[model samples]
Target: MRTAIVVGAGIGGVATALGLGRAGWQVTVLERAPQLGEVGAGISVWPSAVKALQQLGVTGLEKASVVSAPAGMRRPNGQWVVKASALGLELPVMVHRAQLHELITSGFGSGVTVRTGVTVDGFADGAVRAGGEELRADLVVAADGLRSVVRDALYPRYAGPRYSGYAAYRGIADVELEDGGGETWGRGRRFGFARLIDGRYYWYATENRAAGAVGDVWSAFDQWHDPIPELLEATKPEAVLQNDIYDLPLPLVPFAQANVALLGDAAHAMTPNLGRGACTAMEDAAALVRHVTGPAAIPAALTSYDAERRPVATKLVRVSRNVGRVGQLDGRIAAAVRDGLLLTGGKVAGLLARRRSG
Candidate 1:
């Protein structure tokens, strides 16, 4: 059996290991963390990602997820810019990030092994030095996050992740809401809330801020709509997690080199404007497995994976950046123009749908 070593045990790494194991390859996953887990938050698993999970033999997500009500854009004062009914797009199922992590970790069978607390020092000649041992494999899949050591090692000259001029705060509250919840956009800031499967509410806020800046989360959205304040009040101070948003630069470095392949954020980190970051990573896991299965050779499989995933992921990165820039408009005139355009676009779309139906 072909042997593979996967670095990092995030969702993408674990999923890749499962895929390779199912493809008759012996796989070992190395994670630097002492244990495999995720910080608290909720993720929207879109239709495409759901399909990818199925392809990787992961199940039970449907039972564990809350089918989201249609969502729309709103102003800070709770007036709807576009109603949920007007969206006309299939809504994603909301699942807790930790729940999904546990589900994926539990799917590993006999063909795959995961070792945590193993720090990878370096890679050479198809071998990775970790835990004072040299381990070689037929393939090395780098699923390490945004600051991927493997990626840096391969392409030292490539510029890495760049800040998106915004910081994000996320938390889950134990309160329930009647409406599944939606996003509220304001000048240079936004807040969104959604129901979680566990009878809790997941909320996220973003604002233009310097890196490592600290302030009160409540103060940030104190003037927003009703539920926004309520949710913040319900959240414990320590539960709110903050981080600066960052994405890989355009004209991406090749995702694969020789037998080493970069996956997830390591390959194509993007702004979370579309909530497609994790979905795209799941897509990568599926595509990597598909191209690597029945492989003519390891290098050829890596080449095929690169060819199939790079173009799509690169496009999404650019699209997401553009969306972030538009969403973070701070100027009063610019915000007005944006809001008008959104209202107009929604009306036009609604009109087109009505005409087609009639």
Candidate 2:
């Protein structure tokens, strides 16, 4: 059996290990964390990610996810900017990040070996140096996240992730909303909330701020709307997770070199504007499994994986950055123009749909 070593046990890494194990490869997953887990925020798993999970034989995720109601952009004062019902948009299902991580980790099925607290020091000569030992494998799948050591080793000349000039705070609140939640936009900031499967509310806020700046999320968004303040109030101060948003530069870094492959953020980390980072990572896991499972050689399979995934991941990275720039407009005139265009565009699209139906 082909031997594979997967670094980092994030959602992508664990999923990749499961996929390779199912493909009859002996897989070992090395996670630096003491235990495999995820943060407390909720994840919006779109239809594409759901299908990818199904393809990987991970079941029960759908049962644990809540299909989102029609949601759309809103003004800071609670007026609808672009109603989802009018636009006829499909929303993604919301699942708690921890629950989703548990689901994926549980799918390992004894075929994959997981070693926690193993820090990979370096990758050289097709072998990984970790825990004072050099381990070689037929394939090395790097899913070590945005600050990936493997990526640094591969492209030393390339500067790493750039800050997106915004910081994000995410939390899950033990509160329920009568109306299904959506995002509210303001100058230089935005807040989004959604109901999770377990009845708690998941909300995130972004502000145009310097990296490592500390501020009060509740004070920033207290006057936005009914549930926005309520959600913030319900969430404990300690539960709020904050991070500066960062993404890789355009003309994305290559994802494959020889028998090694980069997965998820390790390959193309992006802003969360499109909510496609984790979704695309899941897609990457499935795609890697598809190309590497056949009778083809390991190097050829990695080449195919790189060829197919690079374009899609890079496109999303660009799109997500653009979306963030537009949504985070700070000037009054620019914000007005953006809001007007969104409203007008939504109305025109709705009219066109009605005309087609008529």
Off by over 4 Å in 1: none
> What C-alpha lDDT, on a 0 to 100 scale, does residue 212 get in candidate 1?
77
Error of 1 at 130 (Å): 2.0
lDDT of 1 at 145: 86
lDDT of each: 0.90, 0.90
Candidate 1 lDDT, tens digit per residue, 156-237?
Answer: 8989999999999999988867866999999999999999888899999999988778857799899898889999989998
> Lowest lDDT 10-mer window, candidate 1?
82-91
Q: Each prediction's Cα RMSD?
A: 1.2, 1.1
